[model samples]
Target: MTPLLETRDVGKTFGSVVALRGVSMTVERGGVTCVLGDNGAGKSTLIKILSGVHAPDSGTYLVDGEPVRFGSPREALDRGIATVYQDLAMIPLMSVWRNFFLGSEPPARGPSRALGGFDVATAKRVAREELRRMGIDIRDVDQPVGTLSGGERQSVAIARAVHFGARVLILDEPTSALGVKQAGVVLRYIAQARDRGLGVVFITHNPHHAYPVGDRFLLLNRGAGLGEYGKADIGRDELTSLMAGGAELDELAHELRRTDTPS
Candidate 1:
């Protein structure tokens, strides 16, 4: 089968400042494509392009073998592309069920529909069911989202995307702010999402977080490509070294050695 999403020599620029150049990768269904980069390394730019927030200045962006030029994120969402940012886009004071159906609340039927309201029962039930499917257990659907742990909050976002039938899930630094255990918790959900056949674009600065769940890795530095590799083609140490631009470590070692030497 064809990849769910693919970019060929994709490039983007801000006025005279180039944000990305000649970068490319494929995101297949049931696969996790991890994009690793540091600040100003085009990670944000690439994600914005994928989520339809901005169009690339060069190269092609394809979805399911079709070239699509999405004018807005809503258009991307209509095409089954959902993005969950680092913040998870959740309201702290809202209930789990409320946040689950925040924007796309299910409409009621018959006379209730005439009253123009939501199907609260169905929403709560469905929210409970979906969370359970993702191995998330909430004490009460009425509990405020802020009351949930970081992992649970991220799980809720992932489940919401799944419930809405998102085909490709673009997660922007979902584990960035969490503790080790919490990050692992979120990673499990990401693996689950991949196993369920949704293409996942996981953007992160942590190679440790990305390596375990990532099937393929794409490294970006200074708005350019290092190379995309399958899991077998790379290792944890090498991935980290490359992300740090390889030789800076050697230079630092040399400098330290000189400093240690008697003058």
Candidate 2:
């Protein structure tokens, strides 16, 4: 079968500024395609194009080998693409189950159905079951989302996406804010999502975080692709070196040494 999502020579330009140029990569079912880039590497532009926040100025974006230009994020979601951004878009004060069924809540049954009330019982039951199925054991579905750890919060978002029939999950720097232990927790759930046959686009600047779980690595630097390599083709150290721009780092270190030298 065709890859779940793909971009061919995809590019985006904002007036005179080229945000991305000739960036290409593929996300396959049951695999993680890690997109590595630092601050201005055009990673944000690529994510926008993929999630329908913006369209590419050139090249093709295909879903399952069929080209598609999504008008809105809803269109992408309708096509089974779910994005879990860093902020997560969850209400801090809301309960876990409430946040899970936020916009797409089920209506109450029996006597309350005609009155158009929310179905609290079924929503709680389903949300609890789904979270548990994803191996996320929330202590209480009634607890405020803000009370959970960063890793737990990310897990909830991932579980929610999977429960909603998402075929592809795009995660935006999910581990950036967490500690080593918490980051490991998020990574585990990412692998969990992939194991369940969902194509995962793991966007991160940290090669260490990506290397372990990534099936493929696409490195980006200043709006261009360094290269795309399968896990077998690239080792962790090499991946880290490329991402850190080893040559540049070496030059900077040399300059610092020169400044500190005695005449």
Candidate 3:
């Protein structure tokens, strides 16, 4: 079977500056593809290309093994490629159910398309059911989304994406700002997405966070590909060191070594 999404030797440039070159990776259904990189490591460029915010200057982007060039994020969304950004694209004051169906509300039947016409009962049920399916137990769907914890908010976004027929879930720094417990909550939900057979692109700089959940690792440095490896081919320590700049860190450590004096 073809991968849910894959990019081949993708390259992007901003006039005189090169942002990405020869970067390639595949996101498979039922697995998490972790894109690991520090700042300025082409993560932003990759996300923009994947979400259709920008087009690659070179190479091909494919969905389901078929070449596709998305002119906008809406086009990507229409193709079942949904991105849940770090900000989550949610209103803090809105209730959980309201936020779930925010832009794409279930319209009432008939010819008249009233602005406020929505199937509230059905929406609430779906919102609740979808959250539950993702192992998120919100006390009440009517409660304001801001009242929930960070992890809960992330779960709400994930469930919302899944409910809207998202075949590929692109998560940007989902665990970056959460506490240990809250981060764990989001990680479990990541696993939940994989179990549900959705191709997951987990973009983050935290190797410790990515190691446990990632099935494949794509390492990037200075806007170039380091390599991509399967879980068995790479371990946590190696992943962390590589992300932290292995030899660079060593040189810095040696340079900073304390000078000893005979006492």
Cα lDDT tens digits, model 1, 1-263, are 99999999999989899999999999999999999999989999999999999998889999999988889999999889999998888999999999999988899988989898999999999999999998888999999999999999999999999889999999999999999999999999999999889999999999999999999999999999899999999999999999887799889999999999999
Best by lDDT: 2
User: Judged by lDDT relative to the true structure, which candidate is superior, 2 or 3?
Assistant: 2
What order do you get sorting by lDDT, best first? Answer: 2, 1, 3
Model 2, 1-263: lDDT tens per residue?
79999999999999999999999999999999999999999898999999999989899999999999999999999999999999999999999999998898899888988897989999999999999888889999999999999999999999999999999999999999999999999999999999999999999999999999999999999999999999999999999999999999999999999999998
Model 2, C-alpha of 220: deviation from truth (Å): 0.9
lDDT of each: 0.94, 0.95, 0.93
Q: What's the TM for model 2?
A: 0.97
lDDT of 2 at 189: 95
Task: Give the TM-score of each candidate.
Answer: 0.98, 0.97, 0.96
Model 3 CA lDDT for position 191: 95
lDDT of 3 by residue, 215-242 (tens): 9999999899999999999999999999
Stretches of candidate 2 exceeding 4 Å from the true structure: none
